[model samples]
Target: MFSSTIQVSVFVFVTALIGFLTYLSCRGQNRSSQNQNREYFLAGGGLAWYFVAGSITLTNLSTDQLVGMNGNQMALLALWEFSAVVGLFVLAKVFLPVYYKFKCTTTTELLEQRYHDKHIRAVISALFFLGSALIFCPAVIYSGSLFMQSMFGVDLPLMYIAVTFVVVGALYAIFGGLRAVAVSDTYSGVLLLTMAVLVVILALQAIDYNFDGIPVERLTLIGDNDSPIPWHTLLTGMIFIQMFYWGTNQVITQRAMAAPSLKEAQKGVFAAAGIRLLIVPAIIVIPGIVSYKLFGDIGDSAYGKIVATVLPDWLSGVFAAAMAAAVLTTFNSNLNSATALYVCDIHESYVNKTPNVPKLSGYVTVLLCLVSLALIPVYQQADSIINLIQQLYGLLSMPILSVFIVGLLFRNVHANAAIGSVLFGVALYSAMSFEFSPMYAPFGLHYIHLMFVTLIACVSFALISNKVIFNQKAEFSLALYKEEEAK
Candidate 1:
């Protein structure tokens, strides 16, 4: 009983310390009234490379990655992290320059500029908002609450813990904006990363570094056809998935875009890429694999159980604090990005040309938080949160990527054509993924491969629909490249 009190005390102390540090770091920076949109959403373009790197890393390195990836309990899942490195590089080298040139506040803003239509931008932004509120936000909350319950052996209802997380995370997004979110993310990231590495070392020690009893498929890097990630699917949809996520997703890209210059943002992205390649893979997968040896097939509960087992009581509190920070950072990052998308892309375009930035964002954040909390029960039924997130994201990921692809790659394409293709891609991927249609089995393709196919189909539909239905010719060329070269 006394040990539990010490653990809770350490958890609260570390959590409060990080929040206080973040408050001090962002104390006077919120005073800018000139271009409140940029100041509030983009941090007035003053974030240094280190904060940018740290925010990008922690924002993506939340409970979803930790609990979900580790839940699989296999080395094969490391491919997700390995592939993400390429995604981050592409974001830095390719997308950053375009965003800088366009001076985009939100990623969808570039679409409006490229297509010369605000409606298409609004459509795409709505999709991003829905994806976050529906899938990413709730999953983070559910998984994080589950982790806390498992780690502390708490008997509290999951909804009670979830509400606490939602309230605290909403406060961060509401009060601090992106600046506080980034600062807190960086601070929490250092603690989380250190603790995660220690957990890895301790887990290995607990198992005496032995791997004799684990199944071969669990230890193998090359996934077979029956595996969650088939080997051939990596060559097809994996790269594009990384591209769409790291390059275009507003929650991740907003950090890079907030930097003062393209070079600074790229530097931050490169640092994040280095971390993903080196540190992220092991910490995410190794603990779960070792837990399998120690506890058998415990599923998503593996990570928290292992942490509780390996760490001393006092240290488990510190780890719990780190995990809580991970949850808050990720949850608030999505909340902040969702607010940015709505205020910049949808609300500003449709309702008011110049709405109150903070006021409007607070309303949006509250609405999103309520919706996310309500959706927590939906994710609770999933077998694997990580895999479910990946599969379910397909409903929007490829379709949205197609819009950016068409908008950037070709000229004279109608905006409605792109919108049409987006709807088409959603319907097609849904029919393929879910059981309402006959496409899933007949294709005999992994979902990853289906993502590549969906992408190609969406792009093709957009171009072809432009020519056939909309009666506009899309002249394909490297116009972005040519323009950059000339500049």
Candidate 2:
């Protein structure tokens, strides 16, 4: 116990010190250095392709990848890992062009411009931001912390870690803005990927290069349909979920918006996709299969135990540090994005009318910190963080994607179509998840299934009503900012 305590303390201290140094390095340019609001959020329209790639990779490759996806793949599904590759293709080829042309801060801004309706923009933004904060962000933090607590045998209060996470994350953003987040993300991304590679190698070496001596069939994406998750359902559900996550999730898309050019941004997306394609099988799915092989009767809470028993002492400490970094990086990005949505989209547009840049930035940070702090207990007691994150995104994604796709592809989807689509999507998705069950009528679909249903429903609704909903063609002649023009 004493050795474990010393090890964790050393790891925490080193992490804090490195993060503080990163914060200092990024502190040079004040908020005034940003010439416009776009630069403030998008990193001065000059983020190199590498930083864009690193930030997006770090943002998407979080505790969910390590804990939830990895856990599921090891146990019941291998098709899930392949979704990362497929999703990357969609992001690189399908999603980037529209966002590049529109040049939006929040995804909902595209909706407002296309539909010419403030109500649609407000609803989409609110749902996206809330789902990210209340569900995805907190769940990832909780999953990572759960691993830490189990690994170190430290009964560290969830409240303490939650407060610390929010405060430090807010500091990174409020002071340095998006640039700070991007810079720190570069550091975190390297640390995370390196350690993940190490974990894979060490796990393989420990298992005598045979991957837990499992038979060939288990490694392949084929098995009986009677399994808890059939291969057919896994493929369909994961493809849609991955599309919604990579293409539309603000934390990931915001990194692309921070890129210097459309080309560089697309490169970043490609690089991120490449990394996911390589790491998913190595990091998450294999670990799960190995866990079951090494530890008998492994359950959802057994991931850390598997790692601790399998890895050497020094390596275990390193793995824990890497997991913590993943959690911290994910939490920080979400808090930063959520604050931006509130201050830029909601506050300045509605409440403040004219916001003081620095002061508003600080206020947004504090507001998010307090809200996250308040939710610590809720997160601690939550039974299923991964499930919650998926369900929240499932409920909220329909409208956001509906408007985004309409604006990008159709260019004539009416504002009312966007609004009606969101209303219908959210209500229907929620009802399907909560009200329908197998006993009642074999609602046998999961949350990921519902996300696709919502996506289709919203798209069909938008298309059907386009003619009547969009009575007049909206103007699209707003001049690009000087910085965007320079690009």
Instruction: Output the number of the TM-score-best candidate.
Output: 1
lDDT of 1 by residue, 1-487 (tens): 9999999999999999999999999997755777988888888888899999999999999998999999999999999999999999999888889998989999999999999999999999999999999999999999999999989899999999999999999999998999999999999999999999999999999989998899999999899999989898889999999999999999999999999988899999999999999999999999999989999998898898889889998799999999999999999999999999999998888899889899999999999999988999999999999999998999999999999999888999999999999999999999898876878744588889889999999999999989999899998877686566211
Candidate 2 least-lDDT 10 residues: 478-487
Q: Kindly report which residue pairs in candidate 2 clash with one another.
A: none
lDDT of 2 by residue, 1-487 (tens): 7667767776777577658766775665544543546656767666778888888888777776677655553444445556767776787666666577677786667667766777777777787778766776667666776677777766778666666666666777766667777777877788778877766676667677776467555576664554444566565556777776778777778888888788888888788777767765577666666665676435455567667777677566666766776777777788777766776678867887667665777776676667666665676664545555666666776656766766666655577776787787777777777655432212566556566777888878767765556564433332322224313
Model 1 scores a TM of 0.99
> Which ten-residue region of model 1 has the weakest summed lDDT?
478-487
Give the CA lDDT, 0 to 100, for residue 12 in model 1.
Answer: 98
For each candidate, the alpha-carbon lDDT, in order, equals: 0.93, 0.68
Best by lDDT: 1
